[model samples]
Target: MKTGDQTPLICYQEMTRASWRQFRPTTDGHVAAVSVDRRSQLALMDRRPSPSEIYYRPPAGVYWVDVSVHHAMLHLELPTAEGVFAFRAAIDVAWRISDPVRAVKDGVKLCEPIYRPFLERKLRDMSQEFEVGSFADAERHINTYFADRAVDLPSGVAMVRCIVKLAPEDSARNHIQQRTFDRHKAERRNAEHKAHLHGAELQHDWNTTAHGLAMQSLAHGQETAAVEQRHREELEQQRIAHYTSALQTGGIGVLALQLASSPADVSEVVQIMLHQKQLDLESARDVLNTLMEQRLITRRDVQDVMAPISKVIADRLNPTASLAHREPLPELAAPPVGPVGQVEESEGLDEDESDHD
Candidate 1:
């Protein structure tokens, strides 16, 4: 049928038996109302209503009423969690008149008036079971409640289906979001503080370890230096002992010749000669004569060493005779060394040289 020509979901009227003649003819999608006298003898209609009869309504008659399937969408704010917050809900309610004659007797006309109050009461009762944050759970419970069991309605009406969708109200949703944000912020701050403390502890440990290593290195260095100094002192003592033994065996004259050969020990030998009280002028002259004959020392070295001692010697030995004006010291001959057999061998070498010459 055309939408404009379709029947309303509910209709009711009253008329005399003769005035009922003006009622429109019932179509395939419509149901015609019966007179009060006709209803008492009529059999009950047992067949289920058709899907296409959503807007169908029966024709008018004496004490007439008609009804069809009715669909409605409803909105409500349902309190939850003991009224701490509320959820906004949309309800799609489908209902129909199960008994037309009984519906008229019960004074039912529009389907909304009958279904709205019943749906609100059911939803409010169910909403109390959950919190605002549990909107999804609340919606599921509501859908399941209507789906699992058929609920009875007033005025001979039957329930088809009730679909419920729930969400938090604006204020309740904002409050929940703010709390979540605050909780996360606090957690992040705590984590940062813990990380900072951990980093500081690690740095402190590193510094402590570094300081320990530095102390160990310094102690090792000091120990090594002390060992090196002791080794040097031991070497110097061994060297002095060797020089003293050479002096005891070879005499001052031989030691002086040995010292003159190594120019580096010149200052040391001079110091020894100046300090030796047993060294007489004869021993000193022998040492100098051997040094000159061997060509070991320069004239400059001789002058530098003897210039100061000359005055001391001239003062002790002839005060009237100036040392520079005096005659040179007589050359002292070296005594023969080794056994008589070695001396004879040396005399044989001299004879061979004289014959060759």
Candidate 2:
């Protein structure tokens, strides 16, 4: 019968016939047919007025069921260090079906090309450890399984959610130990470098101070030696002046004694000698006596030298007696008388003769 046109009575008869055909030993088994009125009622109910109600009704086309078939559900569990895991899978199969029925049915082969490979690949790749600690990784694995199988699963299928716990004390201890060791090493190296620099500065200051003191000592020694040499030169000059003055006084005394012993007046002799020699009395006598004893004044002799010496002294002492020693003038003769005087004298002689007689 056609879909939507069969009575309920005919639908019941078709179901019974299909069941018997599946149980029979061979294809040639006897087949019984149901009446037409019963099939028509089942077809009319499947074609309900509301589309929503139609899906709830049984199908009106030819119906069949295999009696020898059985469905099974598989359950699995996995254990790890983290936790326990569980999952389930449902599988269905058909038994003793004809070639035409098997070929026309959907999802008929249990271990078909799509399902067999998909199951094997997912089991091999399952993670032993999940560090991310979330069900997101498991969801991705299930999605990959469905994609390879060419299956469109309903929502909420193949879902996994898990919780993870960790220990906090071990992580904190490791971090503190490393930081403490690094800080001590840096401080020790810095201290050694500072000490070395301070020692070099002290040595430089000592050398500069010693050089300044040495220069000051050399300058003071030169000034002291110059002052002592000047004092010795002034003392030597005073000693030479004293010796020259004593020799001049002794020579003047000796010449005065020699002039006093001469026979001529000492003053006149000394004055004439001083005029000729152009020197003082003591110096002149010393020069003359020395010259005479040496035979150097031979042109003038000294015989009766006392006479000329006394005359020169009298001229100096009495100047008038020398002027009176000059020559006198002669007396004049009387004049004589003549004849008139002679006649008168003869007459006078006669008269004198008469008076006497």
Candidate 3:
């Protein structure tokens, strides 16, 4: 390959019509030379010449005198950055055919046997001149080789163009390697994606569990407070029950002792006063008098409590007594004697003053 830009390929006619028909008079003239070369070239052409179109096929060649020129596909072991590769190059060359009449016998192809070696050196120089991966450089170099060196061919032939390519196996191997690398990369990305989703799911579950635990702790605190409140209420009921029981069993004496400090016992004292589910007149009087002595109640409270009982007693003693409108009574002179207060009839009464004379 060359280091410069590739100019257009130069083609020349094998033999122009003017040169073919010139010098008709001469037997051993240009006609003779043109006829020999033309015979071989025509045979290689394998088609009638058309006025408007000409096609050049593989193995382009030239034959003049004893020279036989040819060009064919050339396989090369090319060193590249990727490693040594089988580079197949199709090259056009000017070649020759046997012509014993002229007694000129030299090269088999148009060039000498050293030509392939020359080309190999050129390829090596090209390998150093351009990077291995540069297809554009290699293409331009090959095209330039054909363009510039076509003038070097035998006098009858021209090279149209030339090109190079990798061998079939190397191209396939490169494609497969690329696809495999892409697949591996995609699989690794998929694995990472799944791992990311799994991590997110685990974190979500942990958060949900933590939230549930916090809610349960709050609910437990609420339940504990409710249980404490119920316990306090039960204790308060028990204390009231104790006070009521003491008052019912021991009458006014127990009530007086319980009411000694009335400020703290105000509610209990009110309950005791209002508790009349079971009572007798004697028990009522005892309770009232004790409450008065304790100063938990006034004398008026005791009188009010005893009023009904005193009226009942008076009615039994004297049915004619109108106690509803009776005056306020003084306090008892003393505690009741016997069953109740009473007076007996005297023994001497004068018998109605001796029968009234």
Candidate 4:
């Protein structure tokens, strides 16, 4: 027998009803031979094969048929869950003649057409369960369904093993790409909004904290100023109390000692005291004449008294004097006196003396 590059089911010869036909096995000897009796159809109905040997020969009045396994790649557009979109599948199928008589009686010329239609119908039904985007799952399902499972193929072809590769069509792929882009864009926008909200909250918190600190600093400053003001007031009160006590307890002498820094101030204080006492030149002369007449105080005794009083006043008023921090004056045998004759009466006292008599 001779084999060419024809299809799996090959017709070597077709004879008339009265003539006889003879054939031999294929060169590869792997192909099955069938005898088809077209008039009575006995061979095809009873599933009979013609004798195929280099030494044997087929009967006459029979059609000679050769059946062999064929490997083919079937490309199909299978329907999916999306009505408009479909999956493109490439199926690698290895099929063979299951019933050779049936192949010849049905006039099956090619094994691919026999099982491809059946596979397409079955795969389309299976693919409708998934969307186009689920190409990988669809591929796995197809391979699993056709793995070692018997498929009812037409015209005596049987499926051996089917390796399927599934993918989305061009339009469906573009649709998936556009949908993914939109989803990512939406997610990015949402993330940016959340970041903006987070930033705003942080800024608000910072402002609040800054405001509170500023208020606290201001309050502290005010409190410090108030404390300083109270301290100054307390110091002023202490000074006033000190001056008042000096005036009440120590009299003009202590006041002079405390305030008088020079002999001129001491003299002014003495004049002010004499004026308050209402003493004029005449009263001073009379007091001196009485003291002279009674001989209780002499001129030299008065001078001696005046001299000590002047020295004491000068020493009390002088800051550098040894007795600067001492008592204002010592107790005297007589009243406080200054240089009466040396003290000239002012013009006002002269006028007052003229009015005295």
Per-residue lDDT of 1-357 in model 3, one digit per residue for the tens? 221112211222344543333322223322212222423432322233454322323222322332223444556655544454434445444322323222222222333343456556666556545434454466576666656444322333333334555332366358656867999999999999999999999999999999999999999999999999999889777656766786567455555555564446654454444334223545755665555445465433344544566665554344224323322233322335232221111101123333564
The best candidate in terms of TM-score: 4
The sequence of per-residue lDDT tens digits that candidate 2 reaches over residues 77-106 is: 322123443222222211122222222233
lDDT string for model 1 (184-269, tens) is 99999999999999999999999999999999999999999999999988976765665576555646555555555655655564
The CA lDDT of each predicted structure is 0.63, 0.35, 0.46, 0.63
Backbone-clash count (model 1): 1
Clash counts per candidate, in order, are 1, 14, 9, 1
Angstrom error of the Cα, residue 183, model 1: value is 4.0
Better of 1 and 3 by lDDT: 1
Poorest lDDT segment (10 consecutive residues) of candidate 2: 328-337
lDDT accuracy of residue 181 in candidate 3: 92
Residue 234 shift from truth in candidate 2, angstroms = 3.3
Better of 2 and 3 by TM-score: 3
**Model 4, span 1-357: residue lDDT tens:** 223226435454554322332333445544555544434442532333333411244333444455455577879999989889999889888766677777766777756656767888889999999988888898898888778875657777677778899989999999999998999999999999999999999999999999999999999999999999999899767645655675446465666554554444444443343343334433554676566556466444566555664565444344234435533433212333443543322323445656896
The order by descending lDDT is 4, 1, 3, 2
TM-score per candidate, in order? 0.46, 0.20, 0.30, 0.48
Best by lDDT: 4
What is the C-alpha local distance difference test score of candidate 4?
Answer: 0.63
